[model samples]
Target: MAYQDEITHMDRAELEALQLERLKKAVVYCYEKIPFYKENFDAVGFDPYALETFEDLRRAPFTTKQDMRDAYPYDLFALPKSEVKEIHMSSGTTGVATVSGYTENDLKVWGDCFARGIGYAGGDENDIVHVCYGYGLFTGGLGAHYGGLNAGAMTIPMSAGNTKRQIKVLQSMGSSIICCTPSYAMYIADTAIEMGLDPKKDFHLKAGIHGAEAWSNQFRANLEEKLDYKALDVYGLTEVMGPGVAIECMEQTGLHVAEDHFWIEILDPETHEPVPDGEWGELVITTLTKEATPVIRYRTKDITRIIPGECACGRTHRRIDRLHGRTDDMMIIRGVNVFPRQIENVCTGFEEIADWYQIELTRENSLDVATLKIEINPDFPMDEIRKIEDLQRRLEQALKDELATKIKVKVVEPYTITRSEGKAVRIVDLRSEEEK
Candidate 1:
């Protein structure tokens, strides 16, 4: 597919050529404006401009989550605080928040990236977008808000929660597109059905942009079927910016990163070295053009590949596959590494289960116990409780067989789990005995 804009639509050679010039500028900007970068570069006896090409990125020290935490508020910004018009931040689950300031021009670039993403997912000027992410501190809400307006669409800044209100606005305004977590969309579909509304017939939705949580392909397919919309994957983190870092197009093959805005590299987790394009590795990004916070080789920990081949949709920008798992989120149970997606994949295989499930990790008998509580549809026959029990037994066996570990399964009433508006917390670990 042809790219949406001239600057973003450039061919690989042209894009890379443009990036080199921007990279040089970014390096100089960082050295001049960011105290942390200036001292680091000076101590290393390295001149940021002397090193050229993407490969030279390795020469710079890799940035980590801790760096952002240490920097706290404006330590990493490449411009004066007076020039910044807005500030965005990480959730600060670990106590210290990583805040990034943005100048007026920076906000324009952010809007442009998100607008490009909207178009990639088949948005047009006439579309009405309902942004269902958090508004303040978090990046998703405002990012989508600006992008929708930038695309010349009627924007609805419906910042999450109050499902009834959200549905009312969606119906009253005739929203054409929605941006939220995939699970939230499913929850909305269920609520609409409960309210005697046919989701497929009542809404004007043509497409949905879903992200902020790791999900399986089966989940995506199911969401498309239930919501009657083309669901696309969006990828990003607060450290990098927000949801518009990269996005999947109508091709639905993989997410195309904005090469002109950020440089991406995949590295082996163990060695912290660059891996081949197809190999699974931790994602590292360099802000070739970021002015507020320019990060060099910042490790993202999310696992995926960068597919360099041209997309059928015709965009020349590199595409990164949907995240499989993250290094920090990987759970180690009895020496076997487990991912939430693996559990999700296993749970969705059961036809009777409602696809909403959570895994609880607790300690008992001096061993780690994994309990999978899943919701089942109400239509399940009361007389066939034994049969359903047998099915649960089989499911438990299947999970152990597939995951190479034993796990307990619990069947619960429908709609038992909490719905997430932002990123869902699916795993709860209580291995206190083991830790002690």
Candidate 2:
């Protein structure tokens, strides 16, 4: 299923060897050019110049998001600002923003990384690629744009918002590939329906590249049903090079990491020790070829396990299971741990609910309370009060069984919840300072 291969189909031993070579080169470059990496390496008594094997990476000090924030504007750049051509950064609404820059070569590498993803989605020059991710500061929009250009496709820079116009463009332009967040894609489908357009028939979309947030396979299936196209996941973050680190091919088995460009590892979130494949752990990564701002052993905080064995698609790169959830995203309710993903799984399981759902947490009576809000599907028997009551009870029971913690469920009328134009807000915590 792989497109003509020069790098993707490399033999396992050959691929690992190439990875080791790039890993060493990047480590040495970072240690010499960036004082930040050198200081961290010296503080940990880890010698990057002497690193001979992948195991040595375990000894290197981690680069956290806080570290990037502490460094602020340009402290982490290995190259001077003059040499850096472009930059992208996180919203950093929570704290100081994390900025990543790219040299000329770095930009090319970013495009190359995402172009492989386009190939995985079966995209070619004949396809008209429409990119709807937000532009400026955010990486999703430009990342997909670069990929489409690299793949020799007719690419459109339709960066986010304007759902009505997006649908019209898709209909008139005959767009075959759509790139945006999973939530925005959902909004586009709903808007098209509101305009009395059948997304499946009216749009010529063949694939949907959805990411910028964690999503479940059940949600993916629902998207496929609405769009009538194979839905794929593209993984990336601004801290690293965005939207090209990994992607799900037609196999839809797991997301294949671009091992040649990024070294990925699963580690115990608490202990930071490496975990084997098939066991859930925090994700850690190191940029192998980034020139402007290379990260060594960056702790992503996201949780996933590696998929064992080779992919049927013939890519030597390893694949990781879709993100289960983030450690920071976990909440304790009634002395029990719960993840929004768990609640989402339960919500998506019921056939009588809409694709949009949210989890809200509040503190009351010295206890943390969680409430799940879901919208009723049009197909649900809304006229029957008994059926509605039964559905609500069933959802509550399903949440209890899934999380082993009781959560209140509120089933509201369709279109009651606000739709998202970008990354969906899945969780809302309103607990005040004293409540915390």
Candidate 3:
């Protein structure tokens, strides 16, 4: 039997008819069980009977991350806690957090979705998949673990932080498929090279699935070259049922959304209105298949465009481009939009600079300033302060040209910045002005 999303390849009437059924049931489910939904529906003068199709979804209030946090423990759950078999919370980078509960069936649904994602990326029963994302409260490790198992691959549940040991396992076990955040994967590839092992030749690895943190095309190409694998982008969020929500096939066109299971909308962040197809906007998701903790029109701050053309891979579900940047993370500097990925790309352009860098944005003397602290390669000449100063000045000019904003670049010694086993925080916005 094919996955639910495959139905979109069917006749248009058939696909729409199926979606109509799911949307109707989801609306009624929310109206009856979730107090927040019930109140919002009443305030909008909407009755459950009125929402019989996907179009009626616009009448419902959008669900924000705050709503999930407000509900907390079990308020978002469509079913009773007795049916909830697992709970996963979002990694809090800001204020109150959102958590998701999974019923036994919900786990199976995710496993199936991930299994499909893995298969699309060339994973099979013969491959040994090493999942390095942290376990515990975070969903990446378990998501990859169960997905690998469901795909019938040999599963390594090596959670992140032990870099040296992970390298040994990958080398000794002859692992074929690796799964982790792009940064950790890069670190592992670097570790293997440092141990005098050519990662491409020493390992039988053929594929990698990378996500959890935003990355750039340059970083993706670097990792692919280091590991000698076709790195496929995987996307998900804890609030939306974790990793494997969408994936890129070998075509590498963009990530295909599991549209049959989740209703997705691209909306203007300020107006909360759906944008025309092919436009960039915040991604809003409503879980059509989830039972334990169902959400309706949850606004995901992730920014990406939904491409609707038929992919060469034959998947009918729509594809979303690799995230450009988050709506929340887009920094305004002198009226120009700047992203951390752009800064990293600029730093990596110089061989003399190490990858360790931080971008500090602050206000001084009524002008916004961006200070970039980058580490210099150890091989640089010791008695070359003038050369180093020149390189710094050149980098500042290059960044100013690329980002269209004035920037200050400082070159520090090697190993000056802290290395992380997980996602690295690169941006620090420090303005005395209060956020609205």
Candidate 4:
């Protein structure tokens, strides 16, 4: 591909040298402009100029989401509001939403990152990019739009919702690329079948870039079979410049981090110490090229381990395994730590179940109980009571083996669970409501 020639194929030594130079500049930029960073560095007795190698970064204090929230609107921004051309905010599910300011240059860099991602997914100038990510306030929409334009592809800012119209556009406009949450992609595939249109035959889509939520390999396979397109996983956070942070190339082994733009580190979540390569830990990122809001050692909390070598695609950037789950998203149920992704992996692995599922947590007689409500595959013989019961028993056993705890598996009819146009909500915790 034309886009894979330069930085993507740069020498490993050359890439590291470039990263070190950019890292020093980014540190100096933050220390000089952002008071939060300056105070933290001063308190720790660390000087930005003294950062000679990547190892020196450890002396700097870590920046958490809480730090961003405490900074709020503009405290973390390195540039003034006048210089910032755009602003984006986090979903604020945890607490106060984090605000990200972007200068014109920052926006350009963002577009370049997404363009690289699009190219990695086999996108080119002739393709029509249909963006279904939610626009306004959310970064996924506009971020993708910019990327498509950057790739010289015809960009469509369809945003989210109105499933029927979205399908119509896909068929009528001959859109070749789709960008949305993986759950929404499945919902679209289901809706297309209901409309009496075969997604593979009726649409011109060749690839899908899915992110903003965690999904399993089985889910990806199901989507590919249904939509007849290559499904690529994209990873990003609103606070970290959104969906272009890293993306899975055609290799599909792991997501290649944009090392030149963002430096990555894997740290033990509890100890705050670096973990060995290939060991799962929390992901920490430092923005190297961002001018408006340069984050230094921002703790992403997403868990994944780095792949030790270069990808077959010849990209010098390091790749991280698919995210297992977030540190905060781990739930303590009946003294057993469980992540939604783990349950998702187990549930989706069953071919008899549909892609949609919900994990409900409740307390019964002072004991925590987990109920896995999944949709039965529409193709399954639902009328056969014996087959349904047998499937349920097997599913329950699989969940027990994987989770190491007894769980209730409820198989619902197709389309029983509420569908999401944006990020899918998989967990519903009623323990807090019950406590009250």
Q: Root-mean-square deviation of each candidate, in angstroms?
A: 2.0, 1.2, 2.7, 1.4
TM, every model: 0.95, 0.98, 0.91, 0.97
Which stretch of 10 consecutive residues in model 1 shows the poorest summed lDDT?
A: 1-10
Tens-place lDDT digits, model 3, residues 1-436? 2233354355556756777788889888888887888888899887767877677888888888888888887777877788889999986768767889999988998887787777887777878989898998898999989899888889999999889999889889988888898888888887788789999888888888888888777678878899998888898889988998888887888998777788888888889888887898889888887888888888888888888788897877778988877877877777888877778877777888766677888887777778898888778873698999899999999999898887788888876677678877778777765531
The number of residue pairs in model 1 that clash at the backbone is 2
lDDT of each candidate versus the true structure:
0.83, 0.90, 0.82, 0.90
lDDT for residue 358 in candidate 2, whole number 0-100: 79
> Model 3, which residues run further than 4 Å from truth?
1-13, 345-354, 376-383, 429-436
Residue 31 lDDT in model 1? 82
Model 4 root mean square deviation, Cα atoms: 1.4
Q: What is candidate 4's CA lDDT for residue 399?
A: 78
On the 0 to 100 scale, the lDDT of residue 85 in model 3 is 93
Model 4 clash count equals 0
Stretches off by above 4 angstroms in model 1 are: 1-3, 42-46, 433-436
User: In angstroms, how far off is 406's CA in candidate 1?
Assistant: 2.6
